[model samples]
Target chain A: MLLNKIIREKINSKLMLTFTILSCLLVVLIFFGLYYKSSPLFTNNSIKDLLFSSEWFPLKGKFGLLPFISSTIWVTLISVIIAIPFSLLTAIYLTEYADKRFVRMINPLIDILAGLPSVIFGIWGVIMIVPFIKNHIAPALGISSGGYCLLAGGIVLAVMILPVIIHVVSEVFRAIPQDLKNASLSLGATQWQTIKYVVIRKSMPGIIAAIVLGLSRAFGETLAVLMVVGNVVKMPHSVFDPAYPLPALIANNYGEMLSIPLYDSALMFSALILFVIVLIFNVISRIILVRIERSLGIG
Target chain B: MDKRKIEESIFKILMRVATLSIVISLAVILISIIYKAIPVMNWGMISQTPQGGFYLGENGGVLNAILGSLYLATGATILALMLSFPIVFYINIYAKKGSWFVHTVRLCFDILWGIPSIVYGAFGFSIMILLGMRTSLFAGIIVIALVILPIIVRALDEVVRMIPQGLLDASYSLGATKTQTSVKIVTRQALPGLITAILIAFGRGIGDAAAVLFTTGYTDNVPTSLFDSAATLPLAIFFQLGSPVEAVQNRAFASALILTIIILSISILARYFSGKYNKFKV
Candidate 1:
């Protein structure tokens, strides 16, 4: 009976360790799997041309990723720009100023927004933002557009990521010791002065980490951006011009991958780019977050 | 002093405006979807599979997509939970405190969680080709399981980490082995959180379209076997909206409404169970 109990315990522990190792191995597997699949495209085209040139002719063997990359940057930039102030302000309000009842009421709304699928956001973008831009905003700016442009993609993405940023930033704010705020207040600092000088200064790293996470999310968003961002393969001169982001390129063209010689490889290469970029962003933010947690003595 | 007072009031108003706008946007999305969906939503929409030329806006239902989503999400959630539970157990119970291995494992999960589902779809497709398998329900499940594995593990890990050290010491003082303690004590303590994590992952898996796009070949009929192609609600909405026909587009709204309802209920259920189980926790 004693031997059987020991053996069972030993087997259970070993089994758990094996599963943990496999979970860690998955990350490495994804990285190399994408690299191996995309390696074929490098044999045909130089890395510079693949990334820099704007020409994307799968039949002619010319695949330039500049247009897609530029569009992604523009859209992500627009989203971060729009989402940062709004999310930060909202987070500050909820954490610092709002009473318990107000916070409680707002929390579920934020949860619902976060829980909504990307596809639903896509449909909303197509229905509301697209027409609103096509008829009002574009014409107001003296630009003619079909409404499916970088701006539309950016606005939709901003809304989608707002809940994410708000959640993180609010948590960061909540982590600030009430003593710190009280110290400033007792020193005759106004409420705004206390937040501006003490809370914001202390949580700067956490805030930046939250924004980076939101940026990473925006980078890889596929369906919603794919829907509103006109899938035109060209360099966009302005937010009103239609452009295709990298994820959109991959999602749109994967079905026809078998038709071209190196098409599958090219699409895989885009996925790799997205993978690498998101990984770097995540790592950077993780380091920042970890440092903050360590300093705060909370994990 | 006067300038500071002005700034304080101005910023306060700005923050309130921002909060109000966000709440308004949420209301807008829910209202618009419900408004558009109400016209076309009916018993047949959820009860029967597509008839002839459903994509062209003919008579039919999204029964195939609904069933497919349920099957795919259910399978993936189960697979992910099997892996995640063990990983979380090992990290919390077996691993050394603040060890580098634990930290590395956590970093890996975080990175995996950050990766977009589209990349997972691409990777899953490549794996399918390499394994000599076709796009089918099995492929979709595997990919989605990968997508949600990190989400489940991280969530459960957070909850398990909160389990008080005294609780574990008490079990050990009673002469229980680590495995036994983990299985009996830790499991019971974290049961509410575990369920919430599982449900949240399920909601995400079912709502995701990109990860399953290339892996699950869509069909109008419900899948009868693991190897059979499956249709999902998100993909159904996508394909239907692509059609130029207005009726097809309306059906897309109906599909979105159904997806939203399922997701919202899961979240509400998660909240309810978590609150209910709070009384049991120390």
Candidate 2:
């Protein structure tokens, strides 16, 4: 028994040490990748011009990324604006109003939706959303449409993120104590009133985390946004105007790296920016979510 | 009282409408893809590889892409499992639960999970350039494994965490070592969850295009070696859609149909297995 115990301890210690090293390696790889890949842009190009300037003519040695940055912010903001109200309502319906069978049915459906690929979303965006915008929304508003623009990308992103936001929000709502709702109901409050006052207020922190997560997803979304955003390197004047986000720019321009001197570096720098922003968002949301779960006193 | 009742009914209607929209959106996507893909999908499209001018709407199939995706996803899932299983097992068994080190590691994995797939592609591209390596099947496998590591680790961690503390104590009281308990007891308990995690990760890897965009350069030929450049279904659809030819565009829909069928089947199988496993749980 003693001999077996000592052998197990030895193996356990060795395996644990190895895994710890692997964890460290993951952090090193990400930081090193960003630093090493974007070095050319920092060394050769002026950081001020690369960030502040809006002109992005790679062949002419101009590598401005302001257009992509603003466009990313715009599309993400638009998507959040489009998704939040709908997600809130759906979450409320699921938690407060839906029957058990309905909840069970929709839960798996949501999982399947979540598992659907970004490419599938892109195809749907291209075939359905884009043409609908061009033929209906644009013409109604007296604007010429190419069927691919910020609006189309934003709408596609909104749909893709809806499942996530709904899932998170519903969980948060469900986490609120049953007694709270019963108390409100016993006081003559209606279902909506109880939910609006008790459920939504108590779950604010988790809902914020969910919104932040959705924003991060929208900001990082690639294939669907790339297909619909028109890949134009310009500041969009309106939702109907074509524009490029940072991910789309990196994806669309990476193939043409051989034609320009520092184009690859520029794209890498854009990717680094994306990585930093997404990492920050994820860390913030996770912290908030943990706090909320702790406060709920659930394991 | 009357005003409150009116407001409640109105809000209920709005909520129902919002909920219905979600179902409608999913239905529209599935229906439209099937409508367009069915006409172009056939045995020849599935069984044969692309011939000359496949992108130009000539006679050919996406066999190369299907096979390539299977190879890359399987390779990446296996590699990710090898890396993730040890890390997860260490955290759950070796380290003290709720310790600062374990928390930090979990946080790190969460951040890794959130990093954009495009960033992985860029990082992989740079690594390839620094090593003077061309895009190949191996590169895609590595990057996709990196992309899914957090997923597998977190998922398996959740499963391992569910192992009853009493069981571990029982094993220890029986004079069994920690390694024996972990390997014999914990692993047996986590087997079903581990399989589900692996399947979901494989699905994510197979469907991803961004992380493999630069790593796996497109080719119509099925890759026979790790170093060979290979095509994937997502990129295949992307390239096909880019062509102006009408027939080529239909092929893109057909490709999406095939990819969807693969993912849906995996999902259904996973659900079935998980259900079956639940029946056996202690």
Give me the candidate number with maximum DockQ.
1
**Over the stretch A31-71, how does candidate 1's per-residue lDDT look in tens digits?**
99999999999998999999999999999999999999999
RMSD (CA, angstroms), candidate 1: 1.0
Q: In model 1, what lDDT does residue A107 have?
A: 92
lDDT score, residue B61, model 1?
Answer: 91
lDDT of 2 by residue, B52-144 (tens): 888788999999999999999999999988888778877888888888888788888988888889899988999899899999999999999
Residue-wise C-alpha lDDT for candidate 2, range A164-277, written one tens digit per residue: 899888888888999999999999998888988988998898999999999998899899899988988778899999989999888887789857898888888898888888
Which is the leading candidate under lDDT? 1
Model 1's TM-score against the true structure: 0.99
Candidate 1 positional error at A282, Å: 0.1
User: Deviation in angstroms for B59 in model 2?
Assistant: 0.7
Q: DockQ of all candidates, in order?
A: 0.84, 0.71
What stretches of model 2 exceed 4 Å from their correct place?
Answer: none
